[model samples]
Target: MGVQRLKGKIKLISVFIVCLIITVFPVVTHAMRGDCGYEGGISSGEAPNKSSFEYQEVCFITGEPIVFKGTLKIKKTYKNNIINTTYIYNLDNAEKKATLTRTLNYRTEITEKDNGQITEKTYFQKDPYEVIKIDNVTYTLKNYDFTRSSFIDQKPSINFYSGDIWNKKTYQTGGVNSGRSTVTVEATGNFYGYDQYWGSAETQIINYVISSESVKNGKIDKWTGTAKVTLSLTTTKQLKYEENLPEQSSYKGVYMEKQYNESILEYSCKLPEFDSKGVSTDIIKTKSGSLKIETFPQSQPLSVPDISHLRGHWAENDIRILYSLEIFKGDSSIFNPEQYISRAEFVSAIVEAAKEVPKDPAFEKKNTRTAAARKKKEEEVISPFIDVSTKSEYFASINAAYDRGIVSGDGGRFRPNEPITLADALVILVRSVGLEGMAPGKYPVTTFRDNDLIPYYARQAAFVAQEIGLVKGDTRGYLNPNEKLTKARAAALINNFINYMREGIKKVYTEGIVNYN
Candidate 1:
């Protein structure tokens, strides 16, 4: 009987050990999975594990005052040709108090770029009563309203692990009251372990400054400020299993709180002050104080091309304007201002600009006829160029120019890729302005030193272009008609053309028509 009892006890011990292993195996595996190791590789739905606990919390605090400055200028040209200009300047010299409460909702989208960099876009919303104050003025900026959506990019921080430190720079710019302001923020981030009260948490300490200037009419304003901010996030929470609770209800929990204190170290504002006599005066206001902010989790989020190497070029502004209008797109952001432009490119730009021109009834009728002919099945519409295919991207623009008499291809070939000469460009410009037959048959023999070199067929167009200040002679007084036109010259000429169309010769010829003194 004693032997049988001892054997039974051993059997029970074995069973107890087996049951313990079964119960603890999964929990140990889960805990180990949360350890992403020292290496930065993370599996999907892993690492940054916010689901290790029930509730997550986030908080933000500001350390210093936010300084801001702005300027605004407005200019208006009336139909009667009257030009009016106004300038207003504003400088805020006060302790800035602001608090932002954000809940890290989720990673809505992740984009992996060709450069192997991953961009994680997270959506967040601010809590109510986010206060912004500048001295005595409490700005009710709508951007702080709880109903807006806000987002932040987490690319550089995506690979960060516990105890890691990272630095980031951010820039934000926006239009404000006829002016614009730019804010630059520099931040350092400290990563904490996952599964904390705020899972997948990080603390960011930041320093930010703002500078803004604006112009409208004849008024101008300038503003500037500096401040510090602290941002923290606890992205997600893991719910404890409970028999009676709904799964969805358990997973939808988030908490946030924030506090801010800003001391205005230095503050000043320069603005335009008017006296009773309506005379302009400059006024400066300076003050300092302590600003406090309280914040909660936001329910609504608030959310708010570079040209190459054309610096200091004479036609840079013109090129930029044309680019903004989509009339000119240089090869890969390169204006290549000094490079000669091809006939195809020149014609394309001209046609694009013409699209914005006020439609003339006569031109409208011509365009209508052109469109009709293009649609008819029986009308075997012939292309003017044997080289240009209907499938070519520039075909429509070239065809439109041909129909409008803005350009006439040579022979049966458009020679679309050939470098266009100065004389040819002038002829196209002259014809584009509806002055095809208005040029004089004869001009002063001394108008250009190289007059004899001018092609007889292009003399009238050259004369018209020169008379309208659309073309200029070289320093040696030569027309250089046979020379290939450069992109810079083309941009300048196109700018002059647009100006003539808008303001006419009388207003645009402020410094006289001829380049010669």
Candidate 2:
């Protein structure tokens, strides 16, 4: 009777164990399925919620193309066995999106060669979808479920532990006009693995094998065996943001953060190799490739520097105007209006005015000068004066004036600190206005009583200076060309030059006539 009770107890225990297995299997299977979609159990439903609308625009103003071409040769060695795989990809036809603030449109072509067969595929982006059209059949792909599909997808989920499995899916439309065509992907990977190809602790390495298939109308369109993929992630040094406003210098310490993903896909059969291309068909086209994200500061009203001695002076307005334009920086806020200006100071002021001020009112819209053009001009001019060192502040300006034949040195000595005479000032002013060669070989005669006092070399320059209203004699009508140029007179002369250039005055001088309008 005891033996019979033992057998019955064993049967009851077996029945209970069977019931537990039946009940818990489905629950475990469902939990595993939930974790299969993404690297960190991230589901496809979670993607749209994480999509960012706060995009920074990058415009290519010149419409220059961005080209990417590479050939990936992957070799895997285990014991005495070696496997080699080659993947060739080319991305081109990338141009500025005219309608979008910071967008690019491009096409990508990928080729895989293995087992003596070559397979080629091309992809492009249409609004809200990635389309691959081949032989009059369009395969539209939507809802990319993977973080890293290709280079076009800037973000990819690479943070996963060893022995993790994930699944991805993309919905397809067009081609065959049947039920939904779906591409299903299953990947198993070991993240945090070490590989020599990637090197160092600076990179995150992932080794994975993925299987993918496309089903159309309940039939398989294509399928693939396990494809080995080795991927590495390296965070590069941040790139600086360039601003379009010329006056606002770039903030050197600020940079945009970027992550670079390098991956190699090795497969012997057809497998889906694309995520979303990040190409937006709805783009804003602009004539400028540069993106303007912030409001730029406008030029404020000119501030007149205080010069106490110039109060109620005859040349006060001229001094204020030149100072407002930043052409004349008075020493210690004292203009010293009666002090004579040196030759070096005069040339430096002329160069600064030419670069900072616009040639005409119409040109004022372009407020910034071209830095590249200025540097090029500086490089083209070599200093011929022994007194001017390359490190001198006025070296470039003096060299530039000399290159244009506007100013010449005396016996190879610049005499930069020497006071400039009225005759020499006239020559420099006339040449600055594009009238260097317009002077006649001989002037008929001047009514000034002091014409004989003017040197022979400055005769024509003196005549042109008077004709252009750039200079005027004293009340006695005596042209004192030999007198040293004072700070106030220099300011007035430069102000007149500014007016001449801004007014767009054109001058035509015949044998004996001067016509200007």
Residue 386 error for model 2, in Å? Answer: 1.5
lDDT of 1 at 109: 38
Give me the candidate number with maximum lDDT: 1
435-485: candidate 1 lDDT, tens digit per residue:
545565543232888998877657877888777777779898899988887
Q: Which candidate gets the maximum TM-score versus the true structure?
A: 2
TM-scores for all candidates: the values are 0.36, 0.37
| Model 2 C-alpha lDDT per residue in residues 1-517, reported as the tens digit of each score | 0001111111111111111111111110000111111222111110111212111211111112112221111111122211121211211222321221111122323333342222222221322323333333333445433222211110011111122323343435445555444443344443332111111111112222332234433555443323333222211111223334555643212223222222221112222333244222223332211111111111124443666567789998787667766788656266688889999988877765543211111111223445543342212223466677655778767877665445666656677888888887776766544443456665435567898887776677777777777777999999898898898888888877665443223111111111111
Residue ranges of candidate 2 with Cα displaced over 4 Å: 1-300, 330-332, 354-382, 442-444, 504-517
lDDT of 2 at 282: 28
Error of 2 at 144 (Å): 54
